[model samples]
Target: MASKQHRLTGTQSAIYLIISITLNALGNGITVSLNLGSALWTASAVNLSHLVGGDLKLLLMLIGFIAIIVNMILLGGIQWRRAINNLVFMIPFSILVGYSATMFNQWHLDNLPLVLRIVLDLFGIVMIATAVSIYQRVNILLHPLDDFMQIIRFKFFKGNAPIAMWVSFIPPVTMSLIAIFISHRIYAINIGTIFSLLFQGSLVGWADRHVFKTLKHQGLDKLMTAKHQ
Candidate 1:
């Protein structure tokens, strides 16, 4: 059985889910605006979007769906209930990402200076890291990729967070490499992707330890606990 202390009420979970998805969308928008590629999964989706001439948001939805299916298979059976729960947030997440991408494209930030672009990229990365940390703490329905990573980590890595994160990078990096080879150029895997691969885990780990600790100290965790009870 799950620990009552770690479980959240429906309302609390909904609030955290909205915050996590919103931050994720904001990060996606900033990354798109930077024109410097995105973190691993988004970079893969971007490359696929280029290849198929499809919208990035639609591709993300498809990718997320596939991830869930794959995860279900890996776990040895389908759990329709769990899958539906995941899709509840996944659909909104895709929509938000798409909307944010459109908004950022309309902003014309691509014409900015290299320094400004780099700064925005860094900011986006921080937002994404922070969002990921919060999502983990919420302990509710997670993005499929994140869910898959957690499953793999515990099953194979003995719950080693850092190693799990690094291992999770392999698939997207492989996809990016394939995209590069096919295009004979770099489309979505660039400096930002490299930076994410190297530093995102450490950044998220730090945020989990310090940033979220601060939030807990401020009584957010207590509120969730109270509501849950």
Candidate 2:
């Protein structure tokens, strides 16, 4: 029974990871398509890409690498193994996000009616919230920026999730603002960015309590705890 449970857990974890990645990618695509802007970390990456003349995916990867290094430094030592594991996830996820954004942008979604674009942006935000909720529940190695934020939250905020989340927004938002000033154009910070920052945490919390609660009741929550013995 334990063996079977372990296998089931592994499968579920894989599924959850895939779902989170796909949803995140789609959400990114929506933001790109609308030319509105992305979530905080992404906004910084996009802006850097604009200034540095590289693919957004590469820029995101660079940012993620720097974040990981900073995180390790703050923790007082480097963990090479963990850093490699984080890169393993971050690289593929960045590629998918970039590809999804490119494909969606090619559709010229920004040309849609204003109301429709707003609706789609809202949908994207919801998708991102859902993705984050699932990603947290799955308990896998997180993306680099998320891992960095978690460390910061625990280390400084006494593990206060809300406070950590708000604090985590500062660096990325600051970077985005700096990039905007340097470029004299918005690569990825706008009204949508404001809405996302204000509401994404609430939405994720709701999903954790309601959506994930329902999943738990359905026995899916076992997957969250089903690691190898």
Candidate 3:
């Protein structure tokens, strides 16, 4: 009974992976193409690009590697399996985000009015939050940063998703601030960012309760129990 609830089969894992990754890409694509405001971490990377003079792709990849390091710290040891899974997820997800951004740009989403773009940005955040909820529960492969959030949620915050997510923002928020201080310019910080900062994690928590309520977090037992591995 409990095993059945916790078990996610091969087919189920594949299905959830496809759905979550696609949704996440589309959501992030909307923000990147529209140039409105991205989720905090991505925004921080963009802001830092102003000062660092590197490809956005490279910066994002670097940010992901940093996430793995942070995840290692959170887990209290180096978990190579999780780190490799994160990289595997990151590569494909990054590809999808790039292609989706190109498609959105081709569709002229970037031309929308500020008001409409703002609305779309909020909607994009919704999609992202929902994607995070789905993939976290799927527990197959996750974005390292999302993994970081999950670790925080269960490990420190007693499974409080909102507070965990808010805490996870500290590093990226610091990156953005440092970049802004050095560059004297902003890359992506707007109403949409404010909305995400205030509500993205809450959105994730809401999705956990309201969207696909039957999907248990597969593999959570090992994750939450393994003190250092």
Which candidate number maximizes lDDT? 3
Preferred candidate (lDDT higher): 1 or 2: 1
lDDT by residue (42-161, candidate 3, tens digit) is 889888887889888788888889889988876777788888999999989989998999999999986788789888888999999999999999877999899989988887787788
Model 1 poorest 10 in a row by lDDT? 220-229
Cα TM-score per model: 0.80, 0.77, 0.93
Question: If the candidates were sorted by their TM-score against the true structure, best first, what order would they fall in?
Answer: 3, 1, 2
Model 2, residue 27: distance off in Å is 1.1
What does the lDDT come to for candidate 1? Answer: 0.72
Q: Is candidate 2 or candidate 3 better by lDDT?
A: 3
lDDT for predicted candidate 3 compared with the true structure: 0.86
What ranking emerges by lDDT with the best candidate at the front?
Answer: 3, 1, 2
Candidate 1 segments exceeding 4 Å error: 1-6, 49-58, 214-229
Judge candidate 1 at residue 14 and give its lDDT. Answer: 76
Model 1 lDDT per residue over 1-229, tens place: 1123544667876787688779988997889777787789988878767866789878888888988887676566676655676788677776787789889989888888888988888889888877876776674667888767656655566545577788888888787778777876667766778888888777767776776463321212221222211
Q: Write the per-residue lDDT of candidate 2 for residues 1-229, one digit (tens) a residue.
A: 0122232267777887888889988987788678776788888878878876789766777788888788677666666655776778776776887798898888889889998898898889888877776765564656777667556655676444456667778888888778888888777677678788888767766776776453321223222232222
Worst 10 residues of 3 by lDDT: 220-229
Candidate 2 lDDT for residue 206: 70
